[model samples]
Target: MSHDALFQLGMDLEAHPAPRAERAAGPRSTTQTEDTIVAPVPARDADDRLDHFIEKQGIRCAGAHLIIDLYEAERLDDLPYIEETLKTCVEEAGATLLHIHLHPFEPTGVSGVAVLAESHISVHTWPEAGYAAFDVFMCGDAKPEKCVDVLERAFRPSRTAVSELLRGREVA
Candidate 1:
């Protein structure tokens, strides 16, 4: 579930205790302030694309080279196989895998970020709904598209949406 939904559910359950309606309500915490406890909410603006958002969020895009967004994989459950398969594909493509991150499934989605020597590979999966998203980026001679093809073959999803990008270029 989304953070909001989970928080709301907790509040609702606390508000209406089961079986014992006469039970006293829990004490409210008055010490927490939004500014002190929470990260600043990002203002929604027109230019909130992935790169821009990443930049705004203070995340360093490893190599500032290639960025590929692959959406519509089968799910997160297929990751172990995908990881093994991707290892071969990445090796063949000349990219080195530094690390892999697999996040828990969320209401928005289950996403994972892979840190790579050439760049990075990020995967997000929704096994319950049979959907996933992936990213492979690299610098120098690493062919990220090969990784994408391997993912496509492994997942065999209904459809795939891809966005390939070359980052860090400047206007002449």
Candidate 2:
């Protein structure tokens, strides 16, 4: 699929929202800047927010999705080391982990997920190529960006790249 199919979500960037929620008092008013629109939601009781969507960069959405790549990396095929590194990433990201499951592939590659309360961190490795790809998606207060640093440090990659997507951005 093309970049537009992946990120744009059929939203016309220049269009303004037509309907408004019950307005907020004080400084919690809505505003628009550039391509993003910011709107304040009415306060809800703590028990009502079970899914943990968050407000980021003025847009309310599900979470941050980080696409991470590691090149010229080390320890790509080590199962135990991969598990440890993922645990470290979850800790460093401040995400609550529920479980970790990893599988080692033929000849020597690894794939796994660190399931978290907010979301998950998944990895797929190509040991022969000294490359690894990771996806870290989490909601709430979990610092998904921190995982990029942890992965780089743990793998000692000569080259690293990351991209972020605001998941559920169309929910407005």
Q: Report clashes for each candidate as comma-separated counts.
A: 0, 0
Give the alpha-carbon lDDT of every model.
0.53, 0.79
Q: Residues 79-140, candidate 1, lDDT per residue (tens digit)?
A: 46655665766676676565655544444455555565566677666676677766677765
| Shift in Å, residue 58, candidate 2 | 1.4
Candidate 2 displacement at residue 148 in angstroms: 0.8
Give stretches of model 2 more than 4 Å off: 1-51
Top candidate by TM-score: 2
Model 2 agreement with the true structure over 1-172: per-residue lDDT tens digits: 4323422444332243322341222223222233221224345687654248899999999999999999999999998898889889888888777777787789889987787877899999998999999999999888999998888888999999999999999986
lDDT of 1: 0.53
Clashing pairs in 1: none
Candidate with top lDDT is 2
